[model samples]
Each structure stands twice: as C-alpha cells, then as structure tokens.
Target chain A: MDIFNKMFGKNNVSSKTVAKERLRLVLVHDRANVSPQLLETLKEELIKVISKYTEIDNSALEVSINNSEHSVVLVANIPIRVRRSMNTVC
Target chain B: MGEVIVVTSGKGGVGKTTTTANLGTALATLGYKVVLVDTDIGLRNLDVVMGLENRIVYDIVDVVEGVCKIKQALIKDKRYGSLYLLPAAQTKDKTAINSEQMKQLCGELKKDFDYVLIDCPAGIEQGFKNAIAGADKAIIVATPEVSSVRDADRIIGLLEAAEMDSPKLVINRLRPDMVKRGDMMDIDDMIEILAIDLLGVVPEDETIVISTNRGEPAVTDKNSKAGEAYRNIARRITGENVPLMNLTIENGFFQKLKKLIGLRDS
Candidate 1:
C-alpha cells in the first residue's frame, strides 16, 4: 500500500491534486533558493549519516521547503527500513 | 498623500483592468477621490472601460515626458464626481516610460487623490516594474485555472522581492459549480497555494460583459453579484471588516438533476 502510494506520489488523476503537487514542488525550489539538484544532495547526505547506524529506505525520502505565516521551512521525511541496536551505535 | 495600489496579474485576460475600474468606481462612490492610471501603455483599456475614452487629449506619456501637466492629463469620470483616469498613450508601447518616471507620476497623483490605482500590464516585465515602483499595496487578480494560479504565485514572489509587503489576492471569475464538481480549485485551495491575504472573490458574471460593452462598470448596478463583490472589496480597502462574498454552488434542483445525470451547466 505504501509503495503504491509512493508510486502515485501524493498526486492522482485529479487536476486539483496535480496542481497542488506542482505548486508545492515549484514553491519549495523557489523559497529555498536552491536547485532540485541541491535537494537531491541533501537527501544523499541525510542517507549517508543515517545508514551508518540503521538501514534506511533511501528511495522513500521526501525533502521539501514549506512556508508558514512567518517563514519558510526545510522539511525532511525519510522512511526508516531497519533499526540497529545501541551496541553498534556509530 | 493617498494610497497607491497596483492591480496586476502575470497572466493576461484575468480581469485586472475590470477589477481596477470597478474598484475605482466603487471607491469614488464611497466618497473618495480616486485616480485609475493605465500603465499598459499601448493597449489601454481603463479609459474605455470607465467610459472616459473620448475625453483623453493628454495621456500618461505626455505627463511623464513633461509635455503636459499631470493635472491636465487626468480625465474625470462622467458618472462619478471624484473618480478620474490617466489614460495610457495608445501610440507608444510600454518602453515609452521607465520606473523613475512612473514613481514620479504616482507621487504627484497620490497627493491629490484619495487612492491611486495603477492598472498593470500582464507579464513580469518593465511595465510591471513601472506599475509597482510607487505602489504602497498590490492586488493580484487571477482566475481559478492552474496556469493562472501558477502565474499569480510567481507574481507574489516577485512582489515580495520588490519589498511590497502583504500583496493582497483577489480570485476573479470563480465558478462555484466547477469547484463543486471537483473540476476546479476552491477558494481555500487558491489561498493556500498563493499564501496571501485574500481581499475578495469576484464571481463569474455575464453582467460584466454587458457593462464593459456599454463603457460602464458593473459596480454601480448593485444588482450583479460581481458588482457586490467589488463593493465589498472597495469597503475592505477602506479598512472596513467586510466578509468575503460567498460563491458556493447553490445545489438547486436543476443543478442536482444535472449532477445525477453526470452533466454540468454550461
């Protein structure tokens, strides 16, 4: 189910949903003042740090910039695939 | 000095001039001296829409070029005592004026009128720069289409960079029926995406066409929904706490029947 949702990628055939996704993606890039390549670099860096301790689902990472009434925020939501014990903490 | 507001949309044909015209007319009716300046230089429409086209002897170019006094170029509205229009030069294009000249004109107009509303041309270009150079506020108009919304978002970003704080949003020509059928975006969706204070929502009304053809704004009609929306917007501009006009689908019997039959009202 999760994988299917990922395949659909928070967007469906509905025009409204498509518009929402498009606006979100463009606005995130616009507000962060960074290219999409930078976001991929951030995702890679995040994976490198996390993979040292626990196995992670590198494919299901979501990094975006969202705006509020006061400021724009960089938000990261990466799915964890496995957890390692503290005995192997890095 | 008066308030200088720029009515702009990055996309064309989203009712920017109509909004400017109606707002100026409505504001004047509320007893404020308002001047509507057309900054769309070559493609002037404010004068025609305001029914003061023939009275234009001197235009914005003349005033900006120091060929005529600014006062001489302002044509008073025939219906409203306090409303005036500084027509754009039809012979010249947008390149005829620069930001500094526009700022000067706005400064001069602000001292005399209670509100100076500039009708901006579409696109993020020199004309847009000139329109907002002296503006104290911005009102972005856009239809509910995805392309329109996208352009409006871009305009908002540009306005923010221009240091024009809190540019207001006005979603124009919204069709409630389409929204209900899930074919179009609702007002909340637009407000969220644009992330701006929504000043007003003007419903799609055919009366606008009739009035525009007659060289009269529908704001004076009082019977049209779009007119009422414009009136509420005008009052809001005056610092009144007017509620947003409801443009929700009525869901009447015919509408329900159409829905049951999987048909939409044309």
Candidate 2:
C-alpha cells in the first residue's frame, strides 16, 4: 500500500509547468525574431570582436539570448587569462 | 453612464463566459443596467451559459445587418430585470461583424445601459478585435495555471498596445490546497508574474459546473463561495470597498483565533 501510494503520489502533469515552457519558448522567439542560426552567428561575431581587445579563451567564451515579454537581453561571458613573469628579462 | 468593460481570456475554457455572465448578473443585482454582449460569433456560448440561448430570435448579426433593431435583438434576463444580453450569431462567422460595427453597436447600447460587458472570443483574431473596440476597460480572466497566465499576459500586452488603460485581473479556478503544498502557483506569484491590478480570485467550485449545467449562474446561490466571490467583484466594480477574498486562508481555527484576538485586519 505504501509503495503504491509513493509511486502514484504528486506525479501528475500540471498545466502550470506546460504554460511556463510554452511562454519561455515563445518569448525567446518573440523578443528579437532571431533564429537559432542567427544566434550562433552572433556568438561567433561577438567572439571575434572581443578578441581584438584581449586574449579571450575562445572555447570558454559564451554568448546567448535571454528574453522576457517586453525585452530581449544578449548575454556574453568572456574569460581572460593573463600570464605573469616570475623574473625580469635578463 | 458607467463604462464598458470587456471580460476576455486568450485561452479557451478559462471561464471567460462564466465570469461575464456572473459579473453581469451581479452588477445588475446592484441596480445597475448591464448589457452582456457575446462576441464569439459562430461558436457562441455566452447565451447558453446565461440560459438565454432559446430566446435569441434576433441576434447581433440581425441588428448589424439592419434586419432588426438593436432593441429587438437585446434579450432581458429572466432572473435579473436590469440585466440584458446581446448574443452572437450562431450561423454566421466572425468576419460578418467588423470592429467598427461592434463599436457602433456598443456606442448605441451605452446610451441605454450603465455597463456594457463584452464577452470576447478566444485568441487575438478578428473576433477579439471586434469585441474590445468600444470597451473602456478590460478584465482578463485566467486560471491559476501557467498557460492561462501567459495567455492573459499576452492579452494584457495587446490591450496596452491598443492604448487601453490598466486591465484588471481575475484569477479563476484556484485550488488552494495545491497552492499550500507548493504544487501550484499561489495568487501572489501569479500577480507578481502578471504585474496587474487584481480584481478578484475565484476558487474551483463544483457548484459552478452544476449551476452552469442547470443554466443558472453560480452567483445566484449565495451559499456558494464562488458565488460570493463574483458578488464581491460586482461590488468592487461599483466602487464599493469590498475586501478581497483570501482563498489561500481557510475560515477555520487560525482565522477564528485571529478574529477573536482582533488581529484580523486588511
């Protein structure tokens, strides 16, 4: 009885979860009208632009899109590595 | 004259018709002359929900097409003498009535009635445009679920884009037990996500289904909690200071203790 109860308890699908997923996807598309391909292109361009300023770890850098009902947010994370000399050049 | 208000939900089966029927009845009970217009066109149900489907001899199309006058098309509610219904055309599609025609009809109705409540069709389509054309305010009805709330948010945005002022919200069919268990989105969470003024919250009551089946409004039964909530919404619309119904809090030990100690305050 306990096993049956545990197996069936609170595992039902909810409308709220479905709605949240739908809204998330729709908002992502609705904000900038940017397709996934375009996002990839944007990420590549962002990496190229940031490389001119500093040595950015290309593999570690990330760029993506975040959206809400009213606005689209472009998020980018760049990791910069600097090498320090232990002694002055002789 | 009082303003025209449209009760709309972008998602179907979220109780837009039910809310419109109950609110119209409640408003009329308060001595306000209210006219509930069904703008669903071919898929009309507001008339049936209000139990006036059998009486719809001349519908909105007849009035729009000049076959019958608006006065002839309007059906007075059998229960509430002050309430009226302008039903949709069952045979015709939504394309038959344009936004301008709806605006004109509502304008004419405004001369006679204090409140003109339009029951908008689901989706952001021609029917929706026609429904909200002449409304001064909007009331978005949504269930506690995310899909309903998301649709409502979209509808609210559409209303804003149309230059309509702050649309109030009605979160319907909220199951408080699920909310307490952290299974469902609480009222506060919904309000936070939607960012709108809350008109009222209606609990999921089986009495609503029974009453709808009987072709009677749930509000007519005073003993029903959902009925009381609808009445309170009516009172609020009339500029009364009716306290919001707290669905999350049951009227049991905690409530009684708070009241007994005079700690209960809005």
Candidate 3:
C-alpha cells in the first residue's frame, strides 16, 4: 500500500483522501483514549508474547481503534509466518 | 418535560450559537415554546443573535446566584413570543456556575418550554461541561476542514462520556462547488469520519451572516437556504422526517430529461 501510494501519489491523492487517512489514524487512537506511546507498549507486549511461539511480522503489525457508527472497536492485525512448533502447539 | 439539546463544537466559530438561535426560532415558529440558553459564559452571543440582547436584565449567573428568578432572567424574544433567552453573564467566568446548577435550571425550565436549546462554549472545558450538564442529547457543529472535524470528534467523545446519548452532527458552511470539484470535504465524508448520524447540513449562505448581524436568526428569512436547512432540522427534532436538502448546483429540467434519456453522462 505504501508503494502503491508512492507510485501515483501526485494525481491520485485527493485532499479528501488525505483528510480521511489523517482522521482515521487520529480517531482510532482517540476512541480508545489510549496514547500513541501506550499503543506502542501494547504492541511490544503482544509481539513478545506471540513471537515466543511463532515468527510474527512485526513490520506488518497494525494495532489501532476503530469507531463504527455505534461502537468503538479495538483492532489488531498481526501476520504469522508459520504454525508454531509442536512444543508450543501441544 | 422538554428535551434539552446542547449545541457544541470543540472548535470555535463553527456556528453553535447560530444553530441554537435558528433551531429555537424554528421550533417556536412551529408553535412550541422554546428557550435558548447562552452557556458560553463571559462571551455570550446567543442573546445577541436572537435579537434579545438589549432586553437582558439578569442572566444565567444571576439565576444561579439567587440574584433573580429564572423566569425574570428569561427574556422574551423580539419576534417569537413563545421563544425566550437565558443569557449568560458577560462579566462572569466559567467558574461562576457549575453543572449541578445548570441541571437544576434546566429542570425548572423543562416544565414550561417545549424545547431548551443550550449554546455551548467552544472547547472541552468548564463552559462546555456546564452547558451539557443538563442535556439529554447533543448536537455537534463542525465545518468541512480537518481541524474543525477533529475537534468535533473530541467533543463527541466527551458527550458520550457525560452519558448523553447518540449525539447528532450538523455540518455547517459546506461549499457545494468545492465539494463537486473534490476540493473540500463532502457531507458524506464528514459523516464517515465522525461516525455519527447527520442531523442536517447548512450550506454557506450569506443570509446567515446578514441575519446574525441584524441580531435575528436566519430561519425566519425564507429565502436563505441555510435558514431552510435549520427549519428542517427543528422539525426533525420534533419527530418530523425531513429530507436533507441538496445544496449542489441545480440541473435544469432539460438537463434532467437528457440524463434520463441517457444522452448525457451523470
């Protein structure tokens, strides 16, 4: 997505999209009443715990709050490279 | 009991006072008794906008301080007999009154008025707290700009934390031309960002400026599109299902015909 954004960044980037992207980031942090530093702390803790079992994509990890029309959702997307070893799975 | 609605925006100059004045006037014109409370202490403007500024002998501070009765502090509107103004004190700070006093005052007023519209001061501060203390619901006002919408989002969070239910949003000063060109934020974009039910949208109309300067709400000015939007909102508050007005440039009848016949691209 970053590569895609950079490829046609000039003509394709509308002010509305910029506004949406910015708002999305801000509202997510705000909705949870969780500071960015706190989110970082949460992310690190989760990574340490998960990486103990399997190879996790730290670069691809995304943790944020999502606000729908009626509720606030805490969303976490952590990509796993493979299944855990038998020791952890068992 | 009357519903107490607080009109607030965390950012200033986004038209909270104006919406309060116009909505109050519209509800009053519909034959319901309405009272406008200027809760922006020390910098009150709702009375001035309602054209009842000069009639103020007592204010919200006075009523809370026991200097005057609430009825005495309530000033009758120059135009609508059923409408009234509870002006905020010009010399007092936000500390002069608290939320408990506001809740009591609103409780007293609820018995007599059909709608109590509170004009909240900008920011998530003491004034904002006092204004929303008694409110059963909230109406957040914001513009299309990033900063304004950001502040509005913050305020909405506060409103919910204060236990106010499902605060509606009103997007003010929307420019259709800019929206059509994809330059400015559209109403749908704002609703998506804010994640709130849109109460209404008021297009940027000069009549609101002219009318506010004259200390009269624009809703009485039939020709103003902004005024029409506000009246519709007032009706919606009273449980009427009014459609959102299309502020886009009108297509001529022939243009519509051509589009219908697939002769022109939409």
Candidate 4:
C-alpha cells in the first residue's frame, strides 16, 4: 500500500500548482518592494518585540510575506521556549 | 492624434518583438495606418523579424540626432501598404536617444500614423524609459514561466509608477496541451496572479518561428493559430468585444487511453 501510494499519491501536487504557489509568494514580495534584507531586519525586530513577553527559539523562527485573496499578509512563525509569569510581565 | 502603444516584457525571449510585429501587421490589415519602432538599440531584430532589414537606409538614432528626417528613416513594409517600420541603429547604444527625444519622435509619428507601436527593449533601464516616454498606452507580454511572470509583476509596478495605468497583458508562447496535463501554468493562473486586463493569449505555435524566418508576420497566414490570436488581440486593442479563443487541444485515441488510466484530466 505504501509503494502504491508512492507511485500514485493524493498528496502529489502538480508542478504548475507549485509554480503558482511560488509565483504568488514571490509577487507578494516583489509588489511590496520587500527585499530579503528588509525581511531579515523585520524578523530581528519581531524577535525583539516578542522576546519581551516570552523567550523565543530565534533559530526556528520563520518570516515571510504571503498574498491573501484581497490583501498582503505578513506571516511569522515563532517557537516559544518559555512564557513569562505575571510578576515578570510587570 | 493616433495612440502610441509600447510592447514590452521585462525579460528577453518572451516574444515582445514577435507580438509587436504580428499586432502591427494585424492592425494594418484592419485598415489602420501603423508604424513599428524598434527601440532595442545595439541589438535590433524587428527589422529582420518584419523582413525589412535590407532596406534600412536610416535608423531612429539618425532621426533623433538630426542626421536624417523621420520620413527618410521609415521603411515601407513589403506587403502591407499601411505598415511601416522604423529600424534601430546597430552601432549606437541605448544612450544615443533620451526620453525627451523619443517623446518628440512619437509626437511626429502620431500626426501621420493611426497607430504607433513601439517595440520596447527588455529590462528596466534607460532603453525602457525611452520606449515608454511618448506612449499613450503600454502592452506587457509574458510567458507562462515563473521568471517571466515575476519580471512582469515588477514591470507592472514600474509602469504604474510611471503613471501609465491599466496596462494590458499578453500571455505568449502558452502550450495548451501542457496546461491540460497540469504541467504548465494556465491562463487563469497568470491573469489571477498578474491582476491585469488580458489583451490576448498566443499559443505555442511553430508557425511563428517560420513566419519570423520568412520576414513575414503570422497574421498574414490564415491557417496559423497564432495569427488568428493576433487578429483577436488587434480587434481588442481597437475596443472591440472579441471573446478569448478556445485553447483546448482535440482529445484523440492516445488522449483517451491516458484519460482511462487516470494519467490525464477529463
């Protein structure tokens, strides 16, 4: 069954779909004039702001610009190492 | 005054020159006086594409530099009496003509021709600036590839920044069979991502190469599918309500077999 699934899988996406996905992401960045350097700086700033409330795994954080149906979205995925207590928050 | 439309693609080899040549010929066939200007200095090919290379006595550089009048630089088409070509200078670089000079030249041409189609050079540089300097409209040509679409997106932003709003798009060299097989980007995929008004879609036809080799446009061949597509595009440019051409390939015996085995879509 695994071999059959490998040969013909429902999870297999067409190359054009991959191309479309890539183009959507790239165009979102291109249209916003957001360079890789700008995203890097943005990631650092996001880490700085989020670090105040919790300890984050910076190495695992991912930042990117995605295109929604109507507008552009800034997506950030950050792993939390620890959450500050109420006394520490104050 | 007649309108000036620049045919441009940010990346080369995406059929800008071919689009310009075919559309110009098609429009002339529609009884409009058209002139094609090649703006790719130091790498001119529109003349060869139009089969008017041997008659180039003067070029755009000569006209802008006051060495020759614009009329002396214009080359009459071999077939279409209403079609003309302004060849580019092979020796001169893009710097030879500035934006202001191009604007004046376009103004002069507009007085005589019903449509002035400028074949723009690839990339976003001085040549591109010169190409769009005097145009009233812009047409962007892009293929189905990621690189072409990415560059086209950048070109769209640049065109908007230049105050040229609502530039139409032409998807060139699209393979319908590959698209049907889900191996290539479809028209909707391009239109949705680019988010621009589609002027037309030219299929991947070998006749375009043959027509270019013969120095004649595909629009002159009634049997060529690409020619028919260009005709529809020309009508659309003239504000006619022409529907998009059907791009479905005929399902044959092999196609039936493939579909039966779940290798092809229904």
Top lDDT prediction, candidate number: 4
What's the distance in Å from true for residue B81, model 4?
A: 1.9
lDDT of 4 by residue, B140-161 (tens): 9999999999999898899999
Q: Which stretches of candidate 1 lie over 4 Å from their true place?
A: A1-13, A33-90
Candidate 3's C-alpha runs over 4 A off are A1-10, A40-90, B251-266
Model 4 misplacement above 4 A: A1-11, A46-55, A76-90, B257-266
Of candidates 3 and 1, the better by DockQ: 3
Top-TM-score structure, candidate number: 4
Each prediction's TM-score versus the true structure: 0.82, 0.81, 0.82, 0.91
Candidate 2 lDDT, tens digit per residue, B37-84? 999999999988888878888999999999999989999996987999
Model 1 reproduces what portion of true contacts? 0.39
Q: Which ten residues in a row have the lowest lDDT in candidate 1 chain B?
A: B257-266
Give the CA lDDT, 0 to 100, for residue B94 in model 3. 97
In order, what lDDT does every prediction score? Answer: 0.89, 0.85, 0.88, 0.92
TM-score of 4: 0.91
Which order, best to worst by DockQ?
Answer: 4, 3, 1, 2
Chain A of candidate 2: what's the TM-score?
Answer: 0.63
lDDT tens digits by residue: candidate 3, A1-90? 235446647465677778888888787777678888887889999999999977899989988777777777778999988644545446
Candidate 3 chain B — worst ten consecutive residues by lDDT sum? Answer: B257-266
